[model samples]
Target: RDRGGRGDRGDRGGHRGGGHAALLPPGRTPGGTQHAAKEGRASLRVSGVHGPEAGLNGIYLPTDVESHDFSCWHQNDSFYKVWLCRGPRAFWIFQPASQRGTAQGFMISKERHLERPQDATTWRLWRDGGWKVFSTIHVREASPKDVDSDAARGRAPPKKPP
Candidate 1:
């Protein structure tokens, strides 16, 4: 997640203008153009779940975005969902815990705002006996309307027991 601070300045693919770009070694520009990553949005979908958060299996959009760093996603209520980060090996999803309704769901990126996994990958959440586990993750481009719809749904009042 783009923390919006200097925390992600070290390894983020792109370089921010003004002070940071001047520090780079000569003759080597950043991977992409400046502010290029802030163009679009991404969607992350979790499937084949076998844990507490199984019912939360759906498309997640980026909740927080940064101009130079990748976006990050978490549930609106809690923080148990997976975080998308630019790991040594492309994109990786890290699930901190297994608490249900821990947080909201959203998609994020590194280097590129619209970046998605090359293919559906499996990930394991082994914390506390695997409280949140999934077999497949799907990433894709998300439109602004899509995001607004999901946000509306999230804001809708909960229904009472029938």
Candidate 2:
């Protein structure tokens, strides 16, 4: 689903203080591992990784959790939009286009609760038959240099030219 409002900035759910969890940088495993198997285009099992520290803004989903319904504040509109989705295992920060190299999808899950927080935007996911937390990311504010460097390269890129 396109969250952005008719612009590239909103295309990937990018807006000031918009609570959209950022997808894990390509090639980096969710649990912070650096192995080849976890670095490829494999559908990651939620149980494979450890949970994040408490209080960090991120998405969490129980493995057996089949659906998720949640809401977050809209930066531009200053209102909350109810987000809903149903699937085998919930994914917090999902990339819409597998190979488009842009965050252009919606964050979906089952059984969303609570109202939008004015100061902080947060959400949770259920995976591995348990609940987990994930934080939304604001990509538009990212620096051009950083964005270029952070693009998802299926395999590690060669060293930059001097």
Candidate 3:
């Protein structure tokens, strides 16, 4: 630690905000975590220690409870569970249980739902296309305790907004 008290490494490239420090890619951060780059739109990034071989382990899908369909949003509230599988060539698996159905419970089918970014807080699906911004994901994540309760632990979770 230097008498100056930043870091012995000496602020290789960090930014201080609200008394908290965060290191940016190249250098320091300024005024907290600002937009890395002001571009048309950014990639949907769901990051955090998912193993190189790990797919469909950290996050869930926005489609129906199945993954076969290559879609983010469905018409009406129709939703499916899709898993992005990475083997020879990455593909979205509709639902492994689609055939046998969930061994534990019933299937989760939603409708009138359009494809939206799974997490809008971090990214916006941006390309040359135009899309509106809306927090369409009305179904919030249930707490662990709530999920563990027998009501939903073994049975299929109740459809939200019902």
Tell me the whole-model lDDT of each prediction, alpha carbons only.
0.34, 0.25, 0.22
Better of 2 and 3 by TM-score: 2
The reply for model 3, stretches above 4 Å from the true place, is 1-79, 84-129, 136-141, 149-162
What does the lDDT read for residue 36 in candidate 2? 22
By TM-score rank, best first, the candidates go 1, 2, 3
Residue runs of model 1 more than 4 Å from their true location after superposition: 1-37, 63-69, 76-82, 88-91, 96-115, 127-149, 155-162
lDDT of 1 by residue, 9-95 (tens): 342221111222223332111221122233455565544454554544445544432212434433322333443443332333332
List all candidate RMSDs to the true structure. 13.0, 18.1, 20.6
Q: Best by TM-score, which number?
A: 1
Each candidate structure's TM-score, on Cα atoms with residue i matched to residue i, is 0.38, 0.22, 0.19
Q: Which candidate is the best by lDDT?
A: 1
How does candidate 1 score on lDDT? Answer: 0.34
Please give the distance, in angstroms, between residue 57's alpha carbon in candidate 1 and its true position after superposition: 2.7
Instruction: Name the regions of candidate 2 deviating beyond 4 angstroms.
Output: 1-120, 134-140, 151-162
For candidate 1, the 10 contiguous residues with the lowest summed lDDT are 99-108
Give the distance in Å from residue 48's predicted Cα in candidate 1 to where it truly belongs. Answer: 3.2
Model 2 C-alpha lDDT per residue in residues 13-113, reported as the tens digit of each score: 22222334445554322223222221211111111122432212222211111123322111111011211122122223332212112322233222222
RMSD (CA, Å), candidate 2 to true, equals 18.1
